[model samples]
Target: MCFSASASFVGSAGIALVGVATLMQVRTPRTLLFAAIPILFALHQLLEGIVWLGMDGRLTPPWPQLAGQLYVFYAQGLLPVVMPMAIWLLLPSGERRRIVPFLLLGASLSAYNLWFLATLPTDIGQCGHSITYHNPRTREMLVAIVYVIATCGALLASRRRWLVIMGLANLAGLTVVALFRTWAFTSVWCFYAALISIMVYWHFRRERMARHVEEAPQDHHFPAGNGP
Candidate 1:
């Protein structure tokens, strides 16, 4: 959760660096989409920093409201779709088909949430060590369950070990936030997700290294006649 400007800034900077490192490890355009997750999360944290500033009265009028809306736009509107799509893209050809249902579910959830966000009124307030985003229309048990299935489900469906671990971590985070800090679930969960994204960097780096090692023998080996 973005409790203060400093926490938000620290998270933003740290995740930004991890994002860049993850991007550099990308082997193809397909992987690039998933690699960008940390970068997007970094931006997400930055937006929350603005929201914090606005709520604290450190920012001018309208900016706080605008920032809060933008934060929700990402938190509620875009992520549901993007998370599954990213995982879907990262899956192997055989596994890709299996994730379609989750992808569709995510898209549907995103659409419904976007509509609700646009049509309903929203309120943001500080509570305890977190910020609470109030949008009654968007909060429902079914919706929350579907959201978890769409986002975390896709990751869990992945054949990649690292992705499965990431999914499990996210599920744990979601469960904790929902159980204890339902009011601040969005903020708290996003923070947890952003932190977990460091695993993305580790995954990519490991893959890249494995690829290098796999190619090393081939590069070193040569035709018998061509060998010096």
Candidate 2:
């Protein structure tokens, strides 16, 4: 999937449209973060396109380096925390307890990533037509385990059906990415997750439509207007 900049650009454009639509559907703050997922992914992909261009020597230096750094910053440093926190925001009070632990863990992981990203340089390279991003600090076995728990765990713990479904989808994708492209985990997995993010729109759209249906006025017929 990391074949070329064109793929990344085209994918980003499509995602941006879906992302905008999803944002338009948001009616409350609780859903705003979740709904913003698609657009965030769109931006992420767009950044990757710039990285691809830079990597391919079509773009100048510093720009590509900057793009790649930003990409890793979001995918590795910020995403884990956002995933669980977004899930937590969508869950009801009763359902929130299940998500809190992941939220805490994600926060920890994000903090760790931020520290490492600031202190260390993320090494980027090409592997099997994919971009590989590596931060020595984040590449530890324990960190990978915790990263999964923080992101996917919260989604799975969610009572919301769409979130649960998305969680399962992400888990399945994660397994494949883990098995096949471990070196490109950060890049490859994020690409898959970007596609998965479209469900964010679908979920919000379904929710908004359901709300509309519930709020729609119901007609009641009187028995031949007897009082009149």
Candidate 3:
């Protein structure tokens, strides 16, 4: 339940290692963005760790505020867009068209969130064992609905079975967090999303293996003992 600075930092470092390994499995430029998510998630957690330090009274004024802003900027202002875009780009050519609407929707939502987060006031407080971020616009039910369609819907739409599984996992994670800790939704969901990048690692690993099998060199040599 308790998330400390040390714990966040350690988690960040561990995920970063997995993220890098996932990135190494990428076989195409289109997949690079999707593969980079875990790395970005690592940085996101690192920012939260700084926020944790601030909450513990270890950071001076302004620093904590800056960290919190950056954290929210990504969680609220950016993820909806990036998640869909990542999926869109990673999709095979024929399938890319199917995801265009979700990409557009996510981009529009991201723009609204970016504008709101940039202009509005945001505050973070320790709610029980989690950090609760207060952003009025992000709290809107409509916005939450749109955000879900943008992120999870796109993932579910993918032809890739692994992506669909990832989508389901995230949906389950969101429901659990929303049910038990609505106030800490931002913190907990982002953390859960970070862990969900494990699916990304596996997805790419499996895809890479499949690609190798398909592309593996074949022996075209004729038999040495042909009929006279």
RMSD of each: 2.9, 1.5, 1.9
Provide the lDDT at 57 for model 2. 90
- Give candidate 2 misplaced runs (Cα > 4 Å): 225-228
Q: Which candidate has the highest lDDT of all? A: 2
Error of 1 at 134 (Å): 1.1
Candidate 1 Cα outliers beyond 4 Å, as residue runs? 218-228
lDDT per residue, candidate 3, 1-228, as tens digits?
137888889989989998999999987899899999999999999999989989999998788778889999999989998999999889888889878999999999999998988888887889877998988987888988898889898999996789999999999988898788888888999999999988899999998899899999998998689777
Q: 31-141 in candidate 2: lDDT tens per residue?
A: 789889999999999999998998889999999899898998998789989998888888777778989999999999999998998899889888878999989999888
TM per candidate comes to: 0.93, 0.95, 0.94
Using TM-score as the measure, name the better of candidate 2 and candidate 3: 2
Error of 3 at 126 (Å): 0.6
* Every candidate's lDDT: 0.89, 0.90, 0.89
Q: Cα RMSD for candidate 2?
A: 1.5
Model 1 lDDT per residue over 76-121, tens place: 8889999888988887777799789999999999999999999998
